[model samples]
Each structure stands twice: as C-alpha cells, then as structure tokens.
Target: MTETIIPGTYIDVRAEGLISAGRIATGVLGIVGTASNGPVGQPVTLALPSQARTRFGLADDPRNPTDGANPLTLVRAVELAYANGASTVVAVRVAGTGKTSASYTLRNDSGQQIAALTTRVPGSWGNAVEVSLQDSEEDCLVERENVESPFNGVRYAPVVPSPRTRVRVVRGATGQAEGFDVVYRRLQSEEQVRPTAAGRFFLDATPVEAGVPAARISVRKPGGVLVDYTGDAIVYETGVPAAGTVRIDPASGELTFAAEEVPAAGAQVTATYGVGHALPTTGQVLLTTWSGDLDFADGEAPVQGDTVEVTYLLDRDSCVQVTLTNAGTVERFVGPDADFLSARINAASQLVSAEPDDLLGNQRPVNDEGLMGSGSNVHGADGANAGRDEYAAGLAALENQLVNIVVLAGQHATTHGDVLAAHLALTANSEHERIGVIGAAGSSVEDINAHGMADGRVVVVAPGIRYPDGITLASGHTAAAVAGLVASVSPQTSLTNKPLNIPDVDQDFNRGQQAQLIGGNVLTIVRKGGFRVLRGVTSEGEGMPYSAIPTRRIVDYARYGVRSAADPYIGRLNNVRVRDALKSSLDGFLTRMVDEEALTGYELDVFADRSQEIRGEVSVVMTLQPTFSIEFVLVTMFLR
Candidate 1:
C-alpha cells in the first residue's frame, strides 16, 4: 500500500539496506515514478506541482502531487507550464518508513527543478499561496472629523494628510458641519493644493483695483455697533463754516478752503476742506472798507445783507487813496466836502458854511469894516469914531494887501531917541498915521533929557537889571548896588557935576596922581601965590590978607567909570598894597556887572531880532548914571 504526503515539506532519512521500507515508499512513489518516468526516462520524470497546486489541485492535472519533489524542479515545470499555456502541475504524494529513504525532485509547472526533497516516514508538507501587497487608490475628499475643543471662539479644522480640500469651520463650534462646502473634487482631480495656512488663504484671491477695496468694509463705534445715516463722503466738521469754496488737493493729505478777508480784531481766521485734502484758503478775495476794517468766513454763501461793519479811521498819508463810495442801496452824504460831513438824508444838499456865531458867539466880527471900531483912538467926535476912520481904512488896506513894510525912522536909535522924535512930529502935526519908532534905552533917555527937558515924556524901564551877586534890581536897594544908586538919584535929573562929597577926597586926589589915571583924564597944577580971598573981594587990611597966594601942588581928578572905577588909578600907586586891593575889588565888581549886563543885553538883542513887525536897528545901551539923556543939540549946534 502507498501513503501520500502534502507539498512544500522537507524530509530526511538514512537510506540503509531496508527493502520493505523502500517497497512501501515505492508504492507512493510508483505514482510519482510513473508520472515522472512517463515524461522522461529519468528515475523521477513526472512534473512537480507548486505549493499552491499541491494544496488546491491543479486545474490542468489533478493527479500530480507536489510532496517529496524538488522545489527547483517545480520552478522549472512552472516555467514550462507557463510557456505551454498551462497554469501548474497537479500534486504527487511521497511516502516512506523507518530507515528507508526516498528523494523527489521539486519543479515548477514548466518542468524546471527548483528544490530537492528527501523523506522518511513521519514528515509533513503543506501548500503555500503567494500574495502581493499593492497600494490602494486614495480619494482626496476623505476627511476625518475633528472632535477636540477649540480655543476661544475660533474653530480649527482637523489636520489631514494633504492640503487637498479647503475645510471651513465655525468660530467656536466643533465636530458639527458648518455647511461650508469645500471644492475637493478639483484638488483630487488636479492633485494640486496650496500649501499656505487656512487663515492666509485669502492672500491668493484676485487682486482688486488700485483704490477700490476687495471686500465690503463696515466702520463701527468702539462698542462694535454701526453708526447710522453717515454717507460715504469724507466730511470735515468744524465749529465754524469755511469762508469760501472747498476743494481737495491730491498731493497733500489735508483739507483746503478759500481764504477770506482779514477780520477787524486781527484774528487769524482759517478755512477747512475735506479730509485728505490740504487747506486751499490762500488766494481768497478780501472785501474791506476804505478804513481797512473787515471780516470773513470761508465756504459759505455771501448774501446782500451779510455785511461786515468795518470801523476805520482814514489815514490820508497812506499812498492808497480810498474814495468813499456808498455801497449801500440808499444814497449817503457827508460833511463840509459833501463826502466827509453830510448825512444820508442830505445827499444832494450842499454843505453849510461855518458862521461866525457858530464858533465865536456874539463877539466882534472879523470883517474889515467892523474891525475899524475895535482899535484905540477912532476918528470922528463920537466915541464910536474916536478919530480912527482914515487910520483904520489905511490899516485895513495894508493888512488886506499883506504888505511887509520895514519902516526906517529918521535916525537909527535903539532907545527912545527916534521914538520920541516921531512922537514930537506927530504931536506937532496932529495927523493920523501909523508909525513905530525903536531906539536904545540910552538914546531914549538922552532924547528925553535933551528935547524933553521940562516934560516927563521918557520913562526908563529896566528889563533884567541884575547886581554883582546875581540879585535883580527888582529885589530893592539892599539887594543890588545899582538899585541902591538908582534909589539915591532923582528921576530925570542931570548927573554931571552932581556934588559927591567923598570924605577922603584929599587921599583920593593924592592916590589918583600917584597912579596914571586909566579910565579918565587927571589934571594937576601948582599954585604959586598965597592970599585970603573973599567971594569976589581981595582984602589988604585986617579983614583980608595982602594978596592971594597959590600952592605949588594942586590936582583935580575925575573918571567916567565906564567898565570899572579902578581903571583910572590902576597903574600909578605909591603904596602897591592899597592899589592892588582897591584894583582887585573894583575889577571884581566890574566883571560881575559886565557879565550880568551882557547876558541881559544879549537876550534883549535876540528879542529885537525876532520882532519882525518892529523895523530899524534896535540896541540897548547902559550908563553908570541913573539918569540918561542925549546931547544931540549940543553936538550939532554947540560944537565949535
């Protein structure tokens, strides 16, 4: 009997001299032997089946067994089977016992030996089926649900193997579908997906226009609530309206408006335009009055009644001349020149004249004829015409002609000399004439003493006579030496040969001869005869002496005292001490007097220079004597 074994098993045995063991194996091997020998003359000519053919019978040959066959031989038989269009050979079993051993060549279905098999009893075999691991087709749309809790309110999609689909997620929800569709079909078909994150996916969206927004924008307040009614326009809000038209400037992001006229308060008024536009208020029109008061607002409509009252004081010195124009609908007028002084109601009326009563009240009129009665000494017997008719008429004519006549009197005397002469002429002639005489005080006194010997027509008046100590004559005799001298002398009296009983006349005479007289002449004589002489009688008896005897030393001294009293005896002196003391004292007094007089005299000269109405040379001459007079008659007639 023969026993069959499965394929794919390896068996080993010691092939000793054991005929029975061989015989039993030969029965099983008879099938293998006959199948192996039928195809070839070799000991085992049958084709070996594959492991798969041994387990599951071959579809082409079912009787063949794969056990106890060489795997290399089976591999060759499989190659031949494949070439012959057969799948595989059938299984052929092998059986053996004890010390007997049998060997079978394993082959593939093509009859090529692939493995060797040796077996005794107690060996096992089985079939092996080949299987291939292949990659499965993937669907890109497949997605796993995300179950993890999201952070905050944002919901993140679950991670996938590839970025094939755009997954949408609710802000805070998880797992539940948000109804957002994903176009995964395109990803799966094209096999392409953007590698950017989900949040940044919008970066790949279509680009928008230069200034336009790709998405709708909503502006809200701080609370995230929308404000209502505001339009899309970029508006600028300010407390005051702009003065003129508003325009946008593209270059600078600032609002601009037209500039208005300057205001009266000198305020810096500004105008505003829309946002992102510059202020264009710079070249605006300014409306102002002649006096320069103005006000303006930009961007607002101007009305006929929208006027700014400008208060201005016209400065005529300014080069720009402004004509007063009545811009108001009603006519207006102004004063004196019609434009400056008239009211609106009196537009066509002429400006009224300024009456004398308007300014001067009921005073005397300034008319030429009316002025005749206002002067001193009018004409006619009545007081109204106090002998000034012809005079007044002549004066009026002279004044009307504005003639500047400089009258030169008969003589150029600064005192009352020429004036006294003129007065005498007028008195003698008794005619009505206008005359002015000017002369020095010295000349006036001289004239008075000469012509006015009996009458007291000339009066001396000192303007600013001062003393050595700067005391004015008005301060009385105690204050000034000149004032004291004036108080001692009688008014209008002759000062020549006036008895001045100097107690020290002898001493003075002696000193006067010792020094050469500096200011005036000195006379000295020697008397030779000596006698007692009565008034116009010479005595020879006891009542009188024999004859008059004259002394050898006789002196007479006098001085004009022009600038100084010591001038006469300043150089000649027996005793230098007495001479120097007297000279110094006298010189000091003379210097003070000269300074005061010179200053006052200079002031008087200035006054005379300014007196244009008074013609002729005016001078003020001073003398040491209190009384002053002129000896003109003595010079003219008595000079022989």
Candidate 2:
C-alpha cells in the first residue's frame, strides 16, 4: 500500500505474481565414516570415483599394516556409493582420538632445521610423505669497493668506510711517517683539520666540540707530542698561558698560547678530533665495529694485488622439489627458496602443509636429506576403531548441507540405533527433509523383526552387499548402496525391482524370507535376475501408512516444494489478493508434481482470515495423496 494523500491516481504494481520457487536438491547424499586421510568432522563433496583414493587414501594401501583384516571404511563406502549411481556425495571423515599428522624437518648443510613440514590433513597417510633438499647454483660475488688512500704521511684522517671494505693506499710519496712507535688504528668518523690562523690567538674553524679529552682530540702543533696524555695543562689557562703552556677554548675555536712564547702570526696547527674509535690517519677500510680503516701504523702503503676477500649470502637459484607421496598418490612442490617453497606448497600442495624458517640472513637449506618417514598410524587412521562420538560429530557437520538421503557407512543401525534415531530426528526437526538407509541386523527374518524401528524416515536393507572379492560381506555398506540407489532416482521413482550394479548380494533370500523381510519393513535385495530390489519400504512395517518408500519420499518432496515456494511470500501483504497469488504459485508447483506423477492428487488452499491477516499470517492447508509403489499382483484365470 502506498500513501496517496494528494495523489490523483496512484498505480500500485504488486510483485506477488513474480514470486516463484527456486531449485531444490533431491538426490544429494551425506555419508560419514572413517578414512586413512582427509579432514575429520568436515564435509567434503566428492564427484569422481577416483577422488576416493586421492582424498581419503586407497583402501588397499599396503602401508595400512592391517589391510588384511582392517579396511579404510570411508574410501570403500564412497567408491561403492558412486558405483551404485550416486553422482554427488557429501563425505565426512569421522575418527577416534589420538589422530596426528606425519611431520618432516628440512635441514641446511650444518644440520640446522630450516623448515618443518606436516601433512595437510591429519592422518596416518601423511607418514608416507617425503621431502628432499639440494644446494643452490648461484654464487656469491665480491669486490664491492670501500676506501682508497695514499702514503702521503701528512696525516690524511682516520679511515671511514667509502663503499670499500679494503683501503687501497699506494706509495704516492715515499717519506717517513709520524707516530711510528704508537700503533694507531683509525676507525670511522675521524676528521683532520689543518688550521692556518693568520692571526695570533683565533683559529678560523667553526664549532669545535667543547672540552673533549686530548686523547680523542689530536692537536699536532709544531713540536707537539701525539701520545695519549691525560693532563689538562694545555687547556686550563684564561686568554694566555705561562711560558711553555698552551690554552685552547673549544667554544671559540681559538688557542691562547704563553704570552712570552707566542708563535709567529699565521702559524699552522693540525687539529684532528672525533676519531670516534680514536685511531690514526687512514681511510675507512678494516672495520672495527663498522668504523675505521686499514693498517697505517708504519705509514706503509698496503701491498699491491693483495685482495681482501669479503663473503655474503648468495641467492641460491637451485632446483628444490618436495614430494609428498601416500598410497601411490604424489604431490610435488618445486621452488628455489625455502620461503617460496613453503608458500607454494602450503597454498597448492594437497598432501602436506609446510612451515619454512627464514633464519637470519634469509638462509637456504643446503643439504640433501630424503625419505622423511614411512607410513605410520594415527587413532582411527586404519580400517577399524570408529565409535559413536566420531560418527555423531561427523553427522553434525552435514546437518546444514542440502542432502536428501544419508547413510552411516560401515555402521549397522541394529546396534547403533541411537545414532539412527538422531538422524531420523534431524529429518523431523530441520527444514531439510531427509531419510536414512540402514542395513538389517542379519539375513534372518527373526533378526529383521527384532530390529524394530518404527520411523518412516529410516529405510532398512537386508543381506548386505558382497565385495568384489566375492567372499567377504559388508553388511553395513548395504545401507550405503541403498541410499545411493534411492538418491539416483527421483522422489517419485520406486526402488522395487531395480537392477543394482553391485557384484552380488551377500546372501540369497527365498520368496518366504523376502516376504517376511518386506513385512518386517526391511528393503530386501535378492539375485532373482542380476541382484534386483524386492521392495521399496521403510523400516516401519507394511501395515503402517508411510511404510511405502515412494509414499514417504513423495510426501517429503511435496513438503519441501511447498515450503520452498511459499517461503518467498513471507512479510508480503497478507491480504486476499496476495494470498491467492501465493496459492496459485503453490498450486502450480503441486500440479507440476502431479504431472510428473510424484503425487496421485493434491488439494491445496492458501487463505488468511481477518484475524490472521491482522497478525500478518497467511496459512496454507494441503492434503497430498502420494503415488504408491505396486508391491503385489493377483490374477485368477478361468480355463482359457
């Protein structure tokens, strides 16, 4: 409704007619079981039959240790589920406790660990993963030059690094050098100043550091000693000093000499300070704590052709590949650097996740180490040892998925009825309508009757399925096969007399036993003509109203469709007109179902009373008659 206070004519276009139902899934199946690999308690959708081996490990993996007796339950179940026409499957790997992934450590040439590798998914299959290391081919080059000097012996300044580690000092002028006895090493940041004062007391320099000790400050005046002296006799006097004493004021950069012994005007005074490390005149080469230079103790030129070798870390561009192999499945990760290898492998490799340690200097692994470990086992990693908790948790993972059918692979409902009851309750509670397929307790009629489950959401199958070996019988997997079979067809298609592509049924049931199994509400499969279904009935007995599998499935499908179709109309105008449009949408859906033969007939009405409309409620009342499967035929023929 639009507000039209002063409007001439307001046209309101209702979009209720445009509301339509969305596509719904009818054949998705959820299966939970134990596997040798794959993440536990997470749903993984599998489409290819070969994905069973790659994701969950091969059933016949020789490293399974007890493959003769125990088998990987998930892989076989998935393989058989796909074998029985299940195109889409949501698989969950449930496991017992104590499950751990196999680990491998990569080391450099010095046996220092550089990277730690673990299986991508936790399981025993990761123990078969292998990794190898190789050295890089790139070499470290040298001679990025530092400092250059000459043997002038005029006190050239303490050497500071000038992009060269070695100071090249040639014999420019072969002369005697000063400070021959004192072995001085000129470090970094040393400045040499030759002051020509022109006048008597003032030096023409700017901002000399105030009051530094004479040791760091080397003032080589005429006939002045350059040894380490601790006395302040040269700097204490004011203006002028007594005879044979010199007074210097660093703030003014002026020197006051003794009045009687004043030097000639414009005398030369060499003041070298800020030696930093306090050494002699040289270029910045031989680094003592990243500072100063080469040997100038004797003022000798450094020997020519004497190369000082400096080392650095090189970028090893060698080929390094890590191979993760388990159950004949191999994933190789190739990179030159450890960090690169780790990033690539962790992002791409499905086998293992890697943690690379880029140590100080960004070092690379240099050694060749191979065959990290063989196949080891984790809890529930083998064929056996799955309990109810793991199964329940795995089923919980699939609760939010759009699965129409489900099966506890390799688990029997006769003993695990609680788990099956939970499965059935999910169907009854959630918006998603689903049914579970379970195998009978045994092939015996008494066993089938004693295994009483009164829920129509549960379908039971008898006699189990025979393995390809034609010897061993997996009774629990029979339910998985039936679930797949149910998922392969539409909800209206009955499972009766359908030919299954399995090798064979575990046991053959006679007509009497088949009748008893059907009456006991168990879906029975026999080898009448290439292993066909005998009945499509739920666990509820034949006398029950919802016992027929097609009846329950059709009802579930209709409920799902109606909910899907009408849910779009929520919060819309709950008046007679929109309610009728909603009714038409639902009616169209049901008519399509009836045309498709999913229902024999359906009576539907969408209505909202004045009180309901006031409460913003539009209710739908439906009475659907589902099409039933034909189970029996009788003919009394006279003499023809």
Candidate 3:
C-alpha cells in the first residue's frame, strides 16, 4: 500500500514498508476511567509515568479526598500500573456530565474579533494555563553605505565590492549597546591572499547548503591557457612535481592544500570566494520591519522619510517574518498577535479548537480579558445503568487497537451483571484475545458466582488492598499489579509459580477470607514473607476448562503466535502452494513454542475445502497442547 499525505500546506511522510506484522505487545495495557484532568474519550499513549502525570494531572488534590472508589482512583491505578512494570499505557479518560474546557478571546487594535484560544481538552486543569508574549531582543535596522572611494589599494574593490559595508540602525534598537556581527554575506570580490605551496583559506560565508560549492579559482599559467575551476568538478592540483588536489570543506568553508600543491613558480593565481558583512550583533535590526524610502550611509544616521509607521513579527523557528507597513496614520497593533501565537502552538499540538477550522484563520484568537471556564462533573451518569453503558462506548473506541489487558476503574458502585458484561465484551465478543481483570466488591465467594462471571477470560478479585501510601486502592487496582506480574515475564515463561511483586498489605486473610480464596476468587493476603497472591485462579469455577491463569495465558500465547505467523500470507491464493506455505509458517512458529516448553505440540489445518475456497475463504484451525504450570505437589515423608 502507498501512503499519501493529507491535503495541506505541509505534511509528514512515512514509508509503508516500515509497517511490520502485528505482534501482541505483552506490556501494553488499556485503562478506562474518569480523571481530574485529561483529554476525554481520547486514547493517549504515554511512555513514562512523568508523562502520565503531566498529561492527566496528578490526583493528589487536597480539594478531593484520596478514597480509592472515587474519580481519583483512576489516577492511583495508573500510577500503580507504571510502578509495577508497564512500559506503555493507553489511558482513555471517560467524561460524564457537566465537564467543560477553559478558554479566552483575543481582539485586534480596531476592537475587531481576532480568534479564541481554549485549553487542550475539557477539565479544571486548563484553569492553570497562562498566556503572555515577549518581544525579540537585539533587533535593529542596518543600511548599506556607499563609500566615496576604495578604502585600501585593493584592485577588484567595486568589481567584487567592498568586503564590508556600514549601515545605520533604523528601528528596534532595544538591546545591548555593543557592536555585533549580525549579517555575514559572501565577499563582493575574492580577497587576493598570497597562497603557500600548501595551506588553507577560511571563506567568509558557510555555504547555504551542502554539496553546493560557492567559491571559484582562476589561474593564469605562464605561456599557457588561463584555467578556471568552479562548481563540483572544480579541483586544485599540486605542482607537476608532486601532484595532489586541494579540497574545500563545504560545511566550514575552509580550503586546504599541501605545500607541494602551490602553483608553479611562473603562474599567477587569483581566488574569488564568497563573503558576508553583518550588522552589529548587540544593536541588531530586522530588514523587513521598515517603511518609506530607504538609503545607505557610511558613518551617518540617515534620516527617515515621511511615512506613518511599520511593525513586524518574526517566527525564529520557521524563519517566517511578517512586516506591516502602515498605509496612513492609522494606529498600528503589534506584539504576539493571535495568529502568530496560534501558529506557534498549533504547529506542535494535538488539541482541537472549539470553533470551526475555517472560521479560525491560520491563528487562533487569544482573549486576555476572557475568563477561563467550562469544567463540569461527570458523575451524573453513575448508579444509573451500572456504568456499563458508559464504559462500553469507551471500549468500543479501542476495538482495532492492540491491548493485551483491559481494566475498568470500578470506583463507583457498579452492578455485578454490568461488570460481567464488560469482561465478556473485552474478551469473548472481541476479535482479539484480551484478558479482563475485574473487581468483586464483596467477600462472599457466592457473590462472584452469582454474577455469572465464571469465565476463563476474566479474573475477579475481592476487597481492596491498603497501599503503603495513605490511600486504600480498590480491588481493581490489583489488576495493575497482576498485569505487571504477567507482563514481566515473556510469553513462554511459566506464570503459575511466579510470585507477584510485593503488594505490601499488612494482615493475613481471616478464616472466612481464606475460605473465599479456596473457592476460586483471587485474593491478596499477608503471608510469612509479604503480601502475596493466594491463588492464580480465574473467575472459572470447579468444572470448567482453562480454570487457572496459566492455562488462559498459554492459550493466549498460542493464539497470538498463530495469528501473528499467519498475518503475512493473508492475500495469497487458496491453492496447495499457499496452503503449504501457511502450514510451514505455522510449523516453524509452533516449533519455537515447543522448544520453549510452552507447548507439548500443535497441529495446523490449512484451507483445503474446495467449496470454501470457491468463496475466497482461507481458514486455519490450530490445535494446541499446552504444558500446564505445576500448581500442586504431593509428597509423604516416613520416619524410620
């Protein structure tokens, strides 16, 4: 497939071949919940925990309590996710009722409407944003002066022009009061420097770009044709006795040659190189910020002619300078205008404007007088339909994206059926293999069983764990630790025996809690060592297949590998050649799994039915035999 840039003045281009086959990224996770601040409904991928704090402001607000079952719970869960071992996280902030963004309006000198500037997204976080402008320092105007005669006895004075020109600062002289080399242009005529047998000449100006030469050489050979060297093919060779070529460093503008490379005794060599004359560095000037008639002077302050006025804005990054020369005596408005600041921000921002793109010109309006507003509460939808309907839409947005695990910040009182529905939707109904870690609020094992959540795809845990921090994180928080523990090892690694990263709880489970754990619900209890998972069981009950986390993990790995291996052959023909190729690819992938001891064996059945092939259907049925994790050990010791 070919890639095309969207219709715009500027576009970023990337090659298609760089897109590789999709492999299940074990450490990548998807989290959905309400946040104090962040883009609502948008899936923002964050690489570092610091980025999460910056993008979705920290939840440590004194205004709100740190109770785990509230909006702030999402923040703690994300922090825990990163703390454990998630390398990349795709956090989607779900916004409910009464949330808005803060904004301001900007106007021009005539009191005419310019544009409006708003926060990157909806949240109270935008209230902290402040906008201001500062003028560029060291800006001045320099006029070129025409001298009466040659300052020195240089023959090619006007032919190459004087090496330097004196100019007067016209405006914007608000900088240090010292001489500066502002503009350095190529010399008018090449300086006639005496060349050594071998030496180097540093040209005044660095070439505008690479691979393009800006200097030329003319040699008048005694009793021979005058030779000229210019452009890329131009070369300077050493005298016939010791022949070698002189070279120019394009970037530094330095010319080098060996001593023996000097011209023969009888030859006269003249070099023509580019030069630059700069304005004062301290009291600098902008060439475009002037109006009326212009004149160049030597050491004279040339007077400005009768004209209204002029102003300019320079974008140092893009080198785009905008100058407005007044038409009449109308008042002029300058400083970081709306459009200038808008272009600067929009150039690197993903935030969208509240107004239509067409109505807002290249620049968005900034209203200094406008009040920051538009934040609201999203909890109005709570306790209505179990919050499942709200989070369902959120999960729908992440359909095509690859997310190995999905966790819902079950801070609010969500119905058991709704939690079960979210789990089934994430794993069973979805085309991708995803495991869901959900929270069961009560201590009764029957509470979990009654929810009908006994599916291999879901892991239900009970009553929250108290973190070392003062806040008591919800049961859903355990999923972060669980996901981290699972993602810490490779797909081939046995997960059953692997101990969890210390959860740091203070007490062991009571008799009733131990009874609940044995019945299949995952729980965290303080053992002799530290806080460890009592069981790795999924929501799956006694009689079902794939009851433990390891079994489910093995199936996920096998399915993920099979799909990844078969992705490359998607559009090939259904004939024996393509089928055999498919089988070979699967065989190789399965062989690695067997070698890693993740699987005992695997069988692959490629598309072979003629009737199915007529409909252009390519199918592959992979039967996997997985190596189960050792969860129980039976031994008897006899005393003689």
Best by lDDT: 2
Query: What does candidate 3's lDDT look like per residue over 107-224, in tens digits?
Result: 4445445655565676656554443322423222212222222211111111111223222333224422222222333332354544544544554455522222445656566877
Would you list the C-alpha lDDT of every candidate in the order shown?
A: 0.21, 0.65, 0.52
Alpha-carbon error at 607 in model 2, in Å? 1.8
lDDT of 2 by residue, 465-485 (tens): 666655444566777878888
TM-scores, one per candidate: 0.14, 0.67, 0.57
Per-residue alpha-carbon lDDT of candidate 1 for residues 1-640, written as tens digits (9 for 90 to 100) = 2344766656544221121100000001011101111111112212343442333223222123333221112222222222322222222222222112222322223434332222211112101111111111221122232323211111111112233432233333233323222211000011111222321111122111112111121223344453221122322322222443222222332223334411223222222111111222422222221211112225422233222111122222211111121112122221111112212212332111111122222221111111111223121111111112222222232222211111111111232233333443343233221112111122222221232211112111111122344332111111111111212332222222222211111112233322221111111111113110011100111132211110000000011122234334324332434334444444444344344331112111111243521443222233231212331244456666
List where candidate 1 sits over 4 angstroms from the true fold. Answer: 1-312, 315-415, 421-456, 460-464, 468-640
Cα-lDDT of candidate 1? 0.21
Give me the runs in candidate 2 sitting further than 4 Å from their true place. Answer: 1-11, 61-69, 107-115, 137-314, 317-349, 355-366, 375-384
Residue 352 CA error for candidate 2 (Å)?
A: 1.9
For every candidate in turn, the CA RMSD to the true structure comes to 74.5, 17.7, 21.0
